[model samples]
Target: MLSTSMRPLTAHLCLALAGGAFTCGARAQQDPDGTAVLDSVVVRSTKQERTLLQTAASIDLVDGQAVERQGLQSLADVAQQLPNVYFTDFTGSTPTLSLRGLGFSDDESDSLSTSVLIDGVPVYGNALGTLFDLDRIEVLRGPQSTLYGQNSMGGLVSLRTRDPGLQWGGSAQFDYGSGNRRRASAAFDMPLGERTGLRLSLGSEDADGHVDNRALGRSDTAGWSSRFARLKLLHTDGAGGEWRLGLHHARREGGNDFFVSTAQAHAHESAASDAGRSDTDYTLLTGEYQRALRGGQRLAITLGATEAHWNYWMPLSQYGGPSGFDSRTRQFSAEARLSSASAPVGGLDWMAGAYASRMDKSAPYLFEVPGYMRSETTARVRGATAAVFGELGWRLAERWRLAGALRLEQDRRRMDWASDQSGYFDSDGDGVPDTPYTSADRIDGLRVRDSEWLPRLTLEWTPAAEQFAWLTLARGYKASGFNLYAYTPSSAATPYAPEYGNHVEAGWRMRGAGNRWDLGATVFHTRLRDQQVVVIGAGGASLVSNAGRSHSEGVELNAALRPTAGLELRGCAGWVRAQYDDYVKGGEDFAGRQFPNTPRHSFGLALNWKPADGWETGVSVRRVGSSALYPDSTVTNAAYTLVDAHVSFRAGRWTLGLYGKNLGDAKYLVRALDARTVVAGAPRTLGVRASVDF
Candidate 1:
């Protein structure tokens, strides 16, 4: 186990900064060529393709090369290191992301605060099983319902996979890592015919876990194996238009991420250490078309269909072992967008679009607990949503701009639950039966209907090229739904209310005189109404409820510097205060406490260098502050710092590399329940890699 001493790191950074070897403050992208010439970044995830200087929102980028150099395996690894964005996983394969301290909870019905998109297809909650074969990842933070609908009340995540270039090319990589881990990946792109191209990529990894399972006498209890493949076809017209068809599939089968609580972490022993299993399978199909119309206008359309299946089992009973669950989800979505490509110079430009989606889910369970609990049940649920949105930007003057957007959305949900089990003792109290819920029950066709309006307004001032300042206000929502599980005697038929948020932000962007330094900063505050919360009720059944209100305020900083040739330093940091403002739950007030899964301070820094001799090296350091685990829960996780380093050399078309992660081998908690159950993070890992391009 690594010791908790980070003082030396701080001293080292201070020395470097004092010597002018490192630069700090705010977010920016520097020249990759070791020159002072900076390049503009075009972002396509914010419902439109706009340059970073032009977009009035906070965004983070993890490009393909960075992905390879860092060996990023999951979304959690990417988000937590960005300024105000954070990611956590209590369950091994499920990823929960929060921006500016919002996302939390594993309950599926909470209405995902953040919406995920691959290419142009929306992938609700199951975006974690696959993070391979990508061109870039775009994280847009803040309320986004004005364009993405309710699911994006908090933010949006977009992942774009590699596309075949106009010429034929490909690359392949293989590596061996700590704990007998191994991975292999390859990609190819080629011209198929006139004006057409095809690309294919495949990746797989398997590893013996970091934790030991004493009860099972296994050194690698939480092992994992994951595989993903993607194929894409692109067609280009002579008239500056394009269309793409994509198919993606991924699978993960392995041990769950649960680890013994730090309090009981000795020898990695746990109450249920010997019996656990988890797996996930996901697939998506997407088609997108874009055309430049004849009358200085453009048209865009996207179509998507996705299916995800996941299951996990934990032997809750030491005697007869009773527990297992599986869930399946399918969704179809489509969107049509139109924008004016040519507007009068220094005048008005606008865009409009409509979106539609239908989703279906079936979650079934089978459990048997010797004499305590036994159940075989299923929750069948369906939901549909539709919206029309538009945005108009007016160049009020040479240096001023005004933009506003609105979305009218409607959503409907239906649920049917059936169950069969053992052990029930309904103690009648106040007309509600107490549990040891026994009996076979079936409930059908419970429904919920909701409608909401999402709106956003912004004003931006550009005093000089590559410099801008903006202020924004937005309102977003998360639709309501019938409970998937019933903790009460008969309230499974009732539904929960919707969750809403209003946000305000102000920020500035600037590029230093020589383009050698660039920075962006933002201060934001959000008011949350009807926050969804999951708690335990009668018979230890899970229940979903609402908190009256909460508030979040934070400042985000991103900065970069290219002091000399082949060297670049970039860092992101944020300080947040999140708490329930008004809380009355069951007539009990729990206000004045911070939210669970939220930290006060988060920061990350990285250095990239390619000195000479075909050699390249990089170092990254990140820290996440400690915080409570749940609302009103006493459990907590200690803050931890992670360090990753890599060294590689290129010869002709081949590259050889070495890498290591979590050098400190810190024993941090990614998840905790009560004070006795917690999940441990990955330990130190090292690897050697080889790659070649053709």
Candidate 2:
């Protein structure tokens, strides 16, 4: 697999080099821009926006130019090229992104370790990260729980979208790929008035799944389609007081596809051959205003509101006999923030803000046939936080710079549950008692309850011009909620305790002109308390509880070298040792068991060459290490590798591109566990795409 993955890369390099020589020879005759292109590269991995060489964090920033060049479809594909970043897609639709080894599963019952942000508005749902139109993606490793809050205890994925400037421009793209896949995307920025601008983006995609479903006489069951549209309006009074409003909407429809082995097919033959998939719709509106205070001070106020609705279908016949389950969830959130750029202390650039946020969630689960018994669940989260953050580039002893920050926050989460019928009702009126419904035995009736003070802090030190290093320590938390499906008459009504964590990290970075190369590495350890884990009994019932503590440590390396002016090479690799610290099972402590679904090793590399004659080409290769099932499963999947390539011809405002993804056609599982199993990463897909700018 590795050799095949490398072959396409080798071929692309030769083609790119040949193309570059011809283009360079012609370009030499033209005048060159004396201005340096330093701005083309960014350093968003860290909170501070410095050059890659100036920061100590191991971060990767994929800019809009790079995103366009690759014709990437989702965050998983984009993250695969970054060292220490791991991403997987169960279907072409859902992508799970993780930095270092701290992130792995996207279980609804588990807390998220990575926080995804869209245009500074943090998005926290399972669907938000799938949207593709973005200006840049910032992958910050280690604990960002302080600045980012909660799930960021592991890492963060912040996506910054394109801004509408003082120009009128727009771009549109269309593509038809293999397997009847069709896609279209377009965006425009125009002046609304004398001091106002408006920008809009729209995209739609549809494709057929690759897996074959013999029961349904179809070769595809994972097919999905999505549509997204967004609008932004900005107004500036030329006095540092600017107000902006943004509105966005998106929808997704899809199902899980897994090819079963011959052994599993003969046993009970329980599977969903014709079940509908999960569907979700998201809508949001946000506004922000900024103005100048006194004495070179600035102030900014931001307000946001969002609502998301999700509908999921579970084919119980696939699990047991013929049973069907459906769940609906509605979420609403609102937040306000006021920040100022003022420092009472000398040599400090400080920002202080008071923030409040509220979130409400409701979900109802019901049986499709027989006696429809409905169970309803709800949760409310309200929190207030006061934070003062400052980064001081203290120029001590010439080239040395020191930086540090502190954050303190408090959050309260409450959960409630109610039901019309116990858990199950005999709707069919059959004396045989259709299917044994969820038996509420030895369980406390569901009610409402609350939990409260999450806190965090960070510090960094850079020594001189040739070296940089930093150490960080922080705390993180995840609120607790009730599970309706896991509830019975004997179930406990009070919500479970929230998870907590203490994370520590240290790293080093070095870069210079010698080889015109940049390199960075980091090691981190985390101690988690009240870790949420699934508990099961002999009857195959499920419940969430504070199982046991765990520890994780990992090392990451990233390097980008410009061997020559026209050629650039980038490589990233990571290794992690994540395990249960004190987990007790079957009367013994399984302290060293590896975390389920967490890859031990992963790496990726990319090479891009720009030759003369408006031509460009690139190739990339990525590898994911093997992982095992949770709860002491003896089965483990082998590792897998993938390859991708791109070639484009550009002239003026028009460009034509050809791309091939998963070129080696490696067959591997992107996500797999009990409940719903998914297999086979997206197959090698080839397509031609065109883009025009005006």
How do all models score by TM-score?
0.91, 0.81
Worst lDDT window (10 residues) for model 2? Answer: 6-15
Off by over 4 Å in 1: 1-32, 35-38, 45-48, 147-151, 264-275, 316-320, 342-346, 424-437, 487-491, 586-588
Q: What C-alpha lDDT does candidate 2 achieve relative to the native structure?
A: 0.54
Per-residue lDDT tens digits for candidate 1, residues 59-168, read 66666555565555677656645666666664456676777666665343626777888886887554465477777777787888654433477788888887777688
- Poorest 10 consecutive residues by lDDT, candidate 1: 6-15
lDDT of 2 by residue, 286-362 (tens): 67676766665555555666666656544443433222233333323333323333233234444344444555555
Cα lDDT listed for each candidate: 0.69, 0.54
Candidate number with greatest TM-score: 1
Q: Give the TM-score of candidate 2.
A: 0.81
Index of the highest-lDDT prediction: 1
List where candidate 2 sits over 4 angstroms from the true fold.
Answer: 1-57, 68-71, 87-92, 103-106, 149-151, 262-272, 291-296, 315-317, 320-346, 367-404, 419-459, 462-467, 489-494, 585-589, 630-633, 675-678
